[model samples]
Target: MLTGYQVAVIGGDARQLEIIRRLNEWDATVYLAGFDQLKEGFTEAIDLDFDSDQVERLDAIILPVAGTDDQGRVDGIFTNRLLHLTESWLKRTPSHCQIYTGISNDYFTQLTSHINRNLIPLMDRDDVAIFNSIPTVEGTIMMVIQHTDFTIHGSKVVVLGLGRVGTGLARTFAQLGAHVSVGVRSSASAARVYEMGLTPLDMNNLAEEMPECDIILNTVPAPVVQAAVIKQLPSHAVIIDLASKPGGTDFRYAEKRGIKAMLAPGLPGIVAPKTAGRIIADVISRLLKNSNREVDGS
Candidate 1:
């Protein structure tokens, strides 16, 4: 249990609420920031700002899954107020205080480094990524169905990057009877694709191979689908870039050629916040178990 522990959960959407629920169940004293519009009150959570006394005694800081944007502002749907997390504010946290976020940025990296504190990036964890792929793949299928008139079965689908998301998508698409083709940077990933009974195309051959692709799903975070590859694609091909923001597609160029391209980052949060929230809450609660125990000892 998180008894006697003071934790501040910063800006986030629905998933953050589950984290709050889990924390409350563990008996942690939670200070909620940027949730002023929350209709239902959590029995154990009190809405407070950084100026409150609890901020100094905070044992942990929980940030949104998206983390802070490039501008250092944390996104908060529940509150109208703009919450900006700054270096000076974080410096006031206790030395052992840990800040948890899904992804890290330049500001977070530098601030944590200068302050000599630990900032946990949840997205970097394999467990989180693997679990998140469930909702992502579901949402991807839903989008594909809604956007495209054609059926997935027997369709020529090309998936870029054989990472966790790519691997899952490929296998699922194959199960749906779609002709799955995977593009991988490394030879090992290509071998894995072949083992899965899916066609593996190297990055060098993407342009040549994309002409027959009906559904182009890009899992690579870098620009692998350039104008050259874009030009080779059929006019009816749809590009689903599941990488981070901006994605890996040449969107403007795809548009010029009449290709449908979309950038989908936080699909898990969008499709199933409760399940996504549970994934985060489970990991975070396990991590905090020790910290909460230490607080009890202190």
Candidate 2:
């Protein structure tokens, strides 16, 4: 249990609600920073603004999945008010205070480094990524169904990158009766794709497969699907770039060719916030419990 522990959940969407629920169940004293628009209230959680002097007393500070932007502006789905995680505010926190975010950026890393504070990126953990893949694949399938005119069965699908999400998507699509081809950077990944009874293509030769691809799912963060690649795709082809913002696909080129191209990031949160939140809450509680025990020398 997180009894007596003071945690500040800064800003987030619906998933934050489940995180708050888990924290309250553990008996943590949660301070909410940017939830003014939320109607629900927790028995143990208190709504507090960023300017509150009490913010410095936190044992842990949890930011949204996206965390702060390049300018330190925190994303708050619950509030219209601008929230920023300033360096001064961070520096004032207790020496033992740890900050937890889904992903870290230059602003977070540099500021935390200069302040000598610990920052945990939850998405960096393997368990979190693997668990997240389930919802991502489901959401991808949903989107494909909604947008495409034809059935997934007998469709030609190509998945870029053999990472957690890519692997799950490729296998699931293949199981659904689609001919799945995975694009991998390394030969070993290709071998694994073949072992899974799926076709494997070199990332460099991705264009060769584009003309026949009915659905293209890109998990690679780099610009692997350029104008040259999009030029070879059929006009009816749909490209779902699941990479981070400004995804791997050439959106402009795809548009010029009249191909359906979409950039979808954070599909897990959009499609299944409850499940995603539970995954986050489970990992976070474990970390907090371990940390609490260490502090008490237990």
Candidate 3:
């Protein structure tokens, strides 16, 4: 029940609060860093300052979903004070201490290499990503329904990239009676798309097929939908780019062409914060349990 472990939860938004609540229910001693902005009255959590000296005492460190930015700044919405995660902080963590984050960035990678410590990305876990896909798909569908005049039934939906999110989106759209098409890079993925009863097209052929789509959902991280692709699409087509910042679609080109384009990242947190937090807490608690088992075994 995480009774003996000291967990330090660093800054995050509403989702973080849910995690804290769940941790408290599990009877974990949680030290909150940079949570001054959090409303008072969390019974089992202690809000502490961001100091390197505290790093040595923790059994585990939990960062936000985005981990850290390129500049090594962790997400801390509660405090105005900037907590920079430096290599020194990593070095100060005890040898057995584990680090957890949602996603890794350049700064995190650098720290991992420099400190020789294992950094587990909760978002990268297969079970977590699979569970998170439900909210993501539901949120994407909600956005499409909200923005479009036409119903998903009989709408032409094109999903770019066959990753977890894209696959879930395609299935959901198709199940809702939309004519779904999936754009993929490999022939194998194309075959899989066809086997799933969705039309499969090469990403390179997006321009040729763009005109048929009423909704284009892009999961690709790069700029796949440029001016050329946007020009081929019908004016009524809505583009949803689900990639991270600087999303896959060319925003300027879409604006110029009058195509409605949206970049929707972190759909789970937006649409279902409590559910998302629960998913994270479940996975993290399992991880902590397994870690404790290993310690006992050794």
Candidate 4:
């Protein structure tokens, strides 16, 4: 049990509640920050401020999935006040204090490096990404239904990137009778796409494949469906860019072309927060438990 271990849960969305609850159940002394307005009823944890003393006592610092933006400002949906993770703040924490976040930015990485603290990016892990693909596919299907008038059955769908989300979503679309075509850059991935019984197209040939597709889902973080690719697609085509910020599609061109384009980053959190929370909470609890063992030298 984490009876004497102190954990500070910083800004986050609905999923943070699950983490707090799980940590509390494990007997950790928890501090909630950047979440003053949150209606979290976890009695074992304390709703606290960003006091320096608290930071020094913290064994672990939990940050949001998105972590800090380019400017090092965290996304605090629970409170109106801005939550910033600065270099000075890390300096206040103890030497062994480690930070946990889902995904991080270059700015936040630099700060953690300077402080010589362990910055764990959970989303980068295989198990987390694979499990996350379930809700992500479900959320994508929801978006496909809401945005498009056409049925999934017998519709031409192209999924860019044969990665975790792309592969899962493509298989689902194919199972639903949508003619699923996967786009990939690597020959090995293309061979795997063929083995899955889905048509695979190289990213270079996307312009040729664009016009026939009724719906285009891009999982690639890079600019794959820009001006050239957009020009190739039918004006009535639907685009769902699931990449992080500034997604893969050209928003300006899509708008000008009168095509429907959606940039959905954290689909799992939005569509199935409870399930997503549980997934994260399970991983976090195990990590903290292991860390506790390490501290106890057991």
Candidate 5:
């Protein structure tokens, strides 16, 4: 149990509520920031202002799974406010304290540099992400079923990118009897895709292969599914872009072509918030415990 370590959980959505609950259960001195919209009764955790003075007392700070954007603004989903994390505020965090976030960007990187402390992106952890991918793929499949007319059993599935999420998506679709084709840049990844019993193709030739596809899942963050690519897709095809905000698909082009395109980020929180929250709590708990052990040893 986290008997002595103090934790500050900043802005997040319903998923974060579970994290706070778990932390409180573990006996951590929990502080809740930007939780004004939440109903009362977290007596174990005090609500604090999101400023340097408040941040300095914590052993660790947990930001939302999306972390702050490029402008140093975190999404206050529960409160509907934007919390800014300036460089000076980051510098106020104790040297022994650690920052935990899901993803990183230029703003986060700059903030960390100013603080001269490491920021752990939990989403970058292989164990965390692989487990998280299950929920993400399930949610994506649910979206596909909800949006498309064709059954996945016989559909032509095109997955762009062969990263963790992309690989999980391809496998899930393939298992559902879809004819899965993965787009990859490297020959090694292409060969790995082939070894997995799925068709592997170079992303450079996506246009030629687009017309036959029934479902296009783009994991690439850039504009991979642009106007040209969308134009080549069948009118009935559905495009699911699982990348971060503003996803990978060209929404305007897809809409103009009568092809449905959706940016479905944060599938875990949407499909299974409780389970996702528990997973994050478990990982954070382990990390915190390890940190305490090291401190005690020193």
Candidate 6:
């Protein structure tokens, strides 16, 4: 139980609700900020201003999956008010008050470092990423079916990146009878792709591969599918860039060429928020439990 432990849940989307519910069930003193517009019948947690004096008593601070933007603006779906997490605000928290977010940018990292507080990026963990890949693949398949006229069977599909999400996407499409080919940079990944009975191509030399593909799924965060690559694709082909915002595809060029392209990030949260939220809540609960044990010298 998180009894006597004080947690501040900052701005977030639907997933934050699960975290708050889980923490409250564990008997933590939960405080909410940046959720003035939310009327979800929250009874266990108390709402507070972003920079309330009670922040100094916090044992942990939970942020959304996106965390703060470049300017420390927290993403709160429930509120229109601008929420910012300044370095000074973080400094007010106790020394042991750790911040947990799904991902972090340079600005967030710098803020935590300057305050000498631990910052945990949950998405960076393999367990979380692998678990999240299940929902991501499901969402990807949903999009592919919705957007494309052709069936998955016998369609030429190309998946970029052999990471957790990429691997799941490649395997699922291949299993669904699509001719799945993965863009692999390393020889190890290429061999693994081959072992999985799917073809692998050089990620850098993707120009030739685009023309035959029915669906192009990009998981690489960088600009892999540029204008040069998009121009080679069949006009009927659909591009689903699953990387983070501003995905790997050239959106302007794709639009100009009349090709359908979608930049879809955080698919799990979109398609299956409850499952995704539970996954995060479990991890966060365990982490806090461990910290609780440490504090108790048990």
Which pairs of residues collide in candidate 6? none
Writing each residue's lDDT as its tens digit, candidate 1 over 167-195 gives 88999999999999899878888889999
TM-score against native, each model: 0.94, 0.95, 0.94, 0.94, 0.94, 0.96
| Residue 2, candidate 3: C-alpha displacement in angstroms | 0.6
Ten-residue region with minimum lDDT total, candidate 2: 289-298
What number of backbone clashes does candidate 2 have, counting pairs of residues 3 or more apart or in separate chains? 0
Candidate 5 residues lying further than 4 Å off, grouped into runs, are 50-54, 292-298
Steric collisions counted per model: 0, 0, 0, 0, 0, 0
Whole-model lDDT per candidate: 0.86, 0.88, 0.84, 0.85, 0.85, 0.88
Candidate 1 shows a clash count of 0
Prediction RMSDs, each to the true structure: 1.8, 1.6, 1.8, 1.8, 1.8, 1.6
Q: Stretches of candidate 3 above 4 Å error?
A: 292-298
**Whole-model lDDT, candidate 1?**
0.86
* lDDT, candidate 6, at 80: 84
Q: Kindly report which residue stretches of model 1 are placed more than 4 angstroms away from their true locations once superposed.
A: 292-296
Q: What is candidate 6's TM-score against the reference?
A: 0.96
What CA RMSD would candidate 5 show?
1.8
TM-score of 3: 0.94
How accurate locally is residue 34 in candidate 5, as Cα lDDT from 0 to 100? 77
lDDT of each residue in 142-194, candidate 3, tens digit only? 99989899999999888999988989999999999999989998999999999
Tell me which residue pairs clash in candidate 1: none
| Residue-level lDDT tens digits of model 5 in 1-298 | 9887789888887779889999999999998877888875588888766643767777888889999888888886677778887887777777778888988898787778677877889999987898888889999999999998779999999999998999999999999999999998899999999999999978877766654788999899987888878887778988999999888788987887888889988889999988888889999999977884356742
Residue 255, candidate 6: how far off, in angstroms?
0.5
**Better model by lDDT, 3 or 5?**
5
